[model samples]
Target: MNSAANAHLINSESYVQKPFTLPNGIVIKNRLLKSAMSEALGTIDNVPTMKLATLYRRWAKGGVGLCVTGNVMIDARAIGEPGNVVLENDKHMSKLKLWAKAGTCNNTQLWMQINHPGKQVPKGLNKNSVAPSAIGFGPALTKFFEIPRELTENEILDIITRFATTASLAKEAGFTGVQIHGAHGYLVSQFLSPNHNQRTDQWGGSLENRMRFVREVYRSIREKVGEDFPIGIKLNSADFQKGGFTEEESIEVIKTLTDDGMALIEISGGTYESPVMALGSNIKESTYTREAYFLKFADTIRQETTASGLKIPLAVTGGFRTTTGMADALAHDNLDMVGIARPLAVDPDYPHKVLSGQAKTNPIRAISTGIKFVDDAALMEVAWYTRQLHRMGVGKNPKPNEGAISSLVKTLLTSGYKTFRTRRLRA
Candidate 1:
């Protein structure tokens, strides 16, 4: 198609597109966002590294509108995984500034995703991981995570403040926005999911109660940063595991967030038992078979928003590969943005390719990272790259753990590191 024709396909008024605007006036250069993918490259102290800078610089240059940093923990003790950058103090501001500058070099919006591990934290990292309630996720698959301790009401409030403080730090460090990581069975997702959150207090039991912590966190962040700073979240459309967070409940939560002034909401799903979002090698193959695995759920939410007259922008990730599919989704589905994680990892310039009409199909393959099953060679290769980025000062270094390679790979997958060669595998 010619430029003018393609422009019409993308938008009617012009053949060229403009930036996507969030509620708070934060404008992304385009509809593409590099979804948060954990690099596990932070320093031993969990500060950002030059390797992280390198990684983001590459992605920023690739042409995505926004690049979200992976898992910057709000509390040191509640880390989601080893090597996750902890954002508890102002001391790390310089490092964060470096990361932001590197990531936004191409005028891309850079958002740091703040989170807590809750029960998902490995026992090796903290034997007493805190949660909204004292509940084990399921059978102990690893020696790492023990039964987590329940957070006191005071602890909950402290965590809320921590989120706000972290957002303030991110803003100071030069981030364009902040994304609360509330998906994939982390602390915030744990509280949102009924199966994990079994508390009797105001923080649990009912859907409204389960959503209270996230609401408070959002309110606190808005209060600390004011309305101009963009705030977004990644939420599960459904947990997929039995008795966990469901589509029905997720819709309700999205509705609540829309009312609470969320600028963007990315739809995702699955948790430990299922691990859908991370592995991408599920037997169900939702994204492979069904384009945009979370579309049905997102459509329901969008319908709800339209019916109720809500205007928050929605970004859908997972199983979005083809440019035509993405364009069709934005034009027909009413979704404001498209999120590409693994494909962007393999080919960072994918968005530019799509927009320039060079590529029409998604480049992601079903190639397994082989780390999912704890392959030694695979683990070592991933560790080497992770450490290499750290050595290069792009991010922090994850502790080498052969058994935890699956989790490590999951983090990498979330960050967009899909292409690899066995020859590149090294410890």
Candidate 2:
């Protein structure tokens, strides 16, 4: 932490430690939310292990108001990564209950983040990838991801049903709430982007048509979980790619979701092709001073919704690195909660430190492998942080100064073996 930056740090005890209630009446004990991280800590069969319980219990006791789990795949056949926990039925009900109970300790709210990867699945990881259109990635990303086939209307309906089933099971397993992984260029984000969804049916062409899939998914889940349970979304403020999901379109989607009774809307940006969500490569220098890369768009949406008499809770989750940045965002009264992700990977008790006024700045640094292409892809950073998560899963403290290149190489080899096993099982 820089001493100059520390000079600007303010006491966060009043703002970040305050409790907030959702529209559905669920109370979050504080404003610090542990945003979802892709903790690939599951069995070879994609079952939730006790390690997840242990890891989340640490976060629960860390004093975060809400803890959203990593992406849990809805279908076993369409996995985005090697070790995603699939929640299709009650066969793993006991394991799910254990994870929920452990994570919901200290009166914390544990929400399950449900996702479908669609064409974002790595090449050969699944039997075949499916999306709204039979489109592939741009030249740079084509080497890693395969071209997906267009999904049929029946297949689309089946996926909607799958989302509902997963949400219903999560509620039964005792999770406090659920959130749709509608950001980071996943299945839901692909449907919302014109650059990805080039279909001509009722599910594409116009923005309304493109958003119909997410609207249906939300409706189905709400019907299954009832109005009292909170159902939120992690949405992209903009895709940051040409002809992609823009800020204006995102605002319209937010308005529609607000009208549709959504509980919260977390703001993030970029895709696998752009990968700006974590890197903040395209952000302005002025925005960097604010510490949150997407604050401009978040402020704009807050004003837009306030004018329309909608009080939707908003959280923005990238490039936040200091107590001053977090407190300033809340002091403006535009953001309801401060979303923290990578910091928690290194220090699970970061929330307690911030709330107790013991820490002024976060201990986060740029993660790079010194290789241009590897660093540009943001692979080294994810690999390094995921290694920290694994350390915590096994009851060890995180090594914040771990070597990035080593973590990248180790993760690549492990992912290669897992992909081979997945292909063999599918065959």
Which is the leading candidate under TM-score? 2
- Please give, for residues 1-427, the per-residue lDDT of candidate 1 as tens digits: 4444454465432211457878777678888878887777765556676777777887788788888887799986666555578888788678788888988997889999999878886445554678888877676344536778899999999999999999999999999899999998888999998888999999999998999999999999999998889899999988898888988888888888988899899988887666666544233454354567777777778787787788758998877776766766665554788887766655666777866767665564443345555432233333433443443343332232323446455556743332122112211
Runs with alpha carbons beyond 4 Å of true place in candidate 2: 1-10, 280-287
Per-model TM-score on C-alpha atoms: 0.84, 0.96
In the order shown, what is each candidate's alpha-carbon RMSD? 6.8, 3.2
| Candidate 2, residue 305: how far the Cα is off, in Å | 1.5
Error (Å) of candidate 2 at residue 175 is: 0.8
TM-score of 1: 0.84
- For all candidates in order, the CA lDDT equals 0.74, 0.89
